[model samples]
Target: MTIGVLVLIIISACSRVDGEMNRVERASGGSPIQVVTTIGMISDIVQEVGGTEVVVTGLMGPGVDPHLYKASQGDMKRLEDAEVIFYGGLHLEGKMTEILEKMENKKLTVAVSKDIDRAVLRSGKDAGGSQYDPHIWFDVKHWISATETIYDALVQYDPTNAEQYKKNAETYINKLTELDAEVKDRILEIPENDRILVTAHDAFGYFGEAYGMKVMGLQGISTASEYGSKDVSKLRDFLVENKIKAVFVESSIPTKSMEAVIAGAKEKGHSVNIGGELYSDSMGEPGSDADTYIEMVRHNVNTIVDALK
Candidate 1:
């Protein structure tokens, strides 16, 4: 079905659930907030801060690309049932923006990165003239700020659990702070000249900015955009000239583009390898170390350092 039809169905379903929303509480007797998030990163923070007080469901899973994600019937049902919905905003969910905006009026829909300073956001080079990058979770410090945003939203939604949410936010933020320091130290092991992070797409602009690395991507910030021969040739030339040993692939994006770049570089006499698969738009699977936000960041950093250092 078309997105508009799906949205209409969801709107109809939401109206039906709106009346019964008051009857649903925490599975237990307490006031547990029902939360739905667009991406795993936001879901992790909500789960951490909400703890037992909230039942959080993430719409996107490991290796799921949010930019191309569409609202499924099941996803719409989940949104209809959820008391609050959180997303990464800034056009991250380009396909579902209109539907999400409509839901905001009916429920507590929030953009977790809404309050971030515009100065910190990377400008998009895509056709849209004024879009900003929405991958805020890459920078640990920005992710910490997002935790506060999540905390405040949770507190506001479930005032009874405000104190608990605050405590959880504090603990999670501290963990992120330590993670920030650890990532910096790890990156330092790599020589400054080798700090170029070439990837499948421009998802890591925030990461490169925060961690002192130069990031280049074959595709634009959003995976929805396509790369032409010129883009590949330019990136290939860059890798050849820099003698960069590695270019990484993203878990969410196809490796064909990076492979093409590597081949083009090889023809130009530069031997570049796939450094490792970085978690660009999504985390890893549940049993893996990169399943959680902290583990995902650590894994990406270790992969980069090991390959580039």
Candidate 2:
């Protein structure tokens, strides 16, 4: 069923936690405010800001693509149980946009990207599609801004714990601020000519704009756009013409298209290596180096810098 239909069907049958009850229950010593996030990035930020006062459950995990992810039955229950819901917004969760929007009427449903400055974003059309680019996390400064948004949502819901949330947000935002600087410095490690970042899709436009790299992809902004041989030929031609040495594959996307581009480039004697796998639409697994938002950014930076430099 379409998410729009699901929003009408299942949601009408579900009720949300009452605001007064939420405050009283917490005041009377109840469970942490149940916070649900659509993607791991937002989940990490909400967890960092909410700290002990919130229980954050992310619907999309490592290697999951938020651009095309749909709400499953279990996901619906999780949303129903949440006191607050945070999503990447900007149509990042394209299929779930309606449900997420309607969820706001009953609870503190937030699109963290909504708090971002529109000036910094690349439109999907700009990136090769229709909506605004949703990969804001690629820009650490933007993600730090998003952290503040998550912090505000938590404080709005649970004002009693505002100070703690403030402390956590400050700490996390400071780290992100440092990360923003580090990414810029690291990107400089590559020669200006080699700073081109080619990936499976145009998911790195924000990264390119923020960190000073030229980005290209076999597919458009969203993976929903199917790639054709023409797309591969074009990218392959560009790689050969530019003498681009490497391309990166994204964890959430299948590697076949990129592999095809690499093969086609080889046919023309332009040997291009798969630079490395990047955490584009998803984070890494638990216990992995890119497990958290900060680590994920670190891993991507190191991978891109190491390969291109």
TM-score of each: 0.93, 0.94
Model 1 TM-score is: 0.93
Angstrom error of the Cα, residue 51, model 2: value is: 0.9
Give stretches of model 1 more than 4 Å off. 1-31, 127-130
Model 1's alpha-carbon lDDT is 0.86
In candidate 2, which residue pairs get closer than 3 Å at backbone N, Cα or C atoms, i.e. clash?
124-129, 124-131
lDDT (CA) for every model shown? 0.86, 0.85
lDDT assessment of candidate 2: 0.85
The 10-residue segment of model 2 with minimum total lDDT is 11-20
Count of backbone collisions in candidate 2: 2
Among all windows of ten consecutive residues in candidate 1, which has the lowest summed lDDT? 19-28
The deviation in Å at residue 243 for candidate 1 is: 0.5
lDDT for position 164 in model 1: 86
